[model samples]
Target: MSETILLVGHGSRAANGNREIEQFVQSWRERQPAWRIEVCFIEFAEPLLDAGLTRAAQDARRVIVVPLILNAAGHAKMEIPAHIAAARLRHPATEFVYARHLGAVEPVLHILERTLRRAMLALDAPDPKTTGVILLGRGSSDRVANGEVAKMARWLHEETSHELVDIAFTGITHPRLETVVQRHSRIGMTQVVVLPYYLFTGTLIERIQRQIAHLRQQYPLLRFGLGGHFGFEEEIFGLLDERVRAARADGTARAEHMMECDGCKYRGLAEPHESHHHDHAHTHAREVPA
Candidate 1:
């Protein structure tokens, strides 16, 4: 039985937001020719999680659900699991595994780095070594979620040659974008750029753009540019593949260990059908090329 991957995103009310997820899934499918992949929305979109999972599980024994969300908030923690539970109740025979969200992974950071570098080039900034980057993320009420953004900034500062790196948010917490721009202006960092660490265009992106426009006018001496969001990166597919494999390995290990110890009810989930075992192994054979 082939393994299927259902890439789920926080479906937006906006049409373009839905298209963005489909486009990303198409790109990911190209890189993963052997594995069966599909895109689904959690809400406010057609072909919801139940429909998507049922279709993918038609011929597959194992399915992995990958959340394209940034943080493990209410949606990621409660809403998503509830949907998965509904799907399992409908198709109890099929095995299901859930992967972590696409947070500040290395590939995401690489995409951010490339986006910032392009923005700097557009501004004709002479030296990246002397440039400072303000990495902006959609702030969250959860402290852990907010820390993820700060951690990404620190990672970029240490990994790249940029002179300084700081994180700011558009909502939910400080330092707000306006305050960060003002602070940088006070320090005389005229070559500062704001990079939006978002996956797609939305109300937040529009608000950030307005803020950048105002900042440019307020601080005429400081150079500012809005970097594009993460879109259509080949590395993103590789990251998805890695996440699937890691989740499968973890699930398999847990199943096997439980069988040996407690003779758990889910022990049968580990035993593969004789005819399906070979196909299952083949499904995981195609790895993203280094």
Candidate 2:
């Protein structure tokens, strides 16, 4: 049976950001020539989910849509599933499977650790005791997603020698990049590094640079270093391959791999304090450590 793997990205306004997804898809194709792979965006970029699905359904018996998302936010929990449902009606002959998003898994966490270590190395091997690391996420109203980033930060802190590892969002939720940086400055951290938890470069990355510039001016005495996003590492391919294999084996996302939606606001399980947060435009850095 012919099978096609459809990789879905969040889609960025920046051309290069979109290109990164396409380039990554190309590399995946090179690595796994036997499997048919297709790339698309959930929004903002060309060949959106619908179109990508249509194309994939054209010549495949099974179509597995794998979200290249780091965390299970609204998009992963709701939006992508809606798209998949719509596609199922349109292409009944082809079996459609929804795979899990790549959360803060071990491989990606290792990547972050390597990136932080490189930044420290670049800054003349600053003493980990006085150095602070700030991890930046895309930020979502979904506390679960934000919490995952925080968890990842904690895991990273455990993996590295950095004395302090703080979590911040680029946009929504509390403690944005600026807030975290300012707090770090006030606390008199000798050296700080900003590591973006992103897959590619986008408008948000540019905004982060601007914020970093302003923070530098505000705290001229502090040594600040910026780290890169999680780019096309070999482990990334391994992760994708794992997702594909799992989808093929089960014809759907594994229950264990799926996001824990017990407390999802969309499911009406929101806490009493849960309220909708304002939405913002979406937005990625350094030669990632190999």
**Model 1 CA lDDT for position 58:** 80
lDDT tens digits, residue span 56-101, model 1: 6788788888877764444554455556667777888888777767
lDDT of 2 by residue, 171-256 (tens): 75778777787788787798889999988888888888888898888888888888988769777888989987877787653522
lDDT of 1: 0.70
The candidate that achieves the highest TM-score relative to the unseen native structure: 2
Cα miss at 258, model 2 (Å)? 2.0
TM-score of every model versus the real structure: 0.80, 0.90
C-alpha RMSD between model 2 and the true structure: 6.1
Q: After aligning candidate 2 to the native by TM-score, how far in Å is the CA of 266 from where it should be?
A: 2.7
Q: For model 1, where is the 10-residue window of minimal lDDT?
A: 281-290
Runs in model 1 lying further than 4 Å from the true structure: 126-130, 252-290
Clashing pairs in model 2, backbone N/Cα/C closer than 3 A? 202-284, 204-283
**lDDT of every predicted structure (CA atoms):** 0.70, 0.80
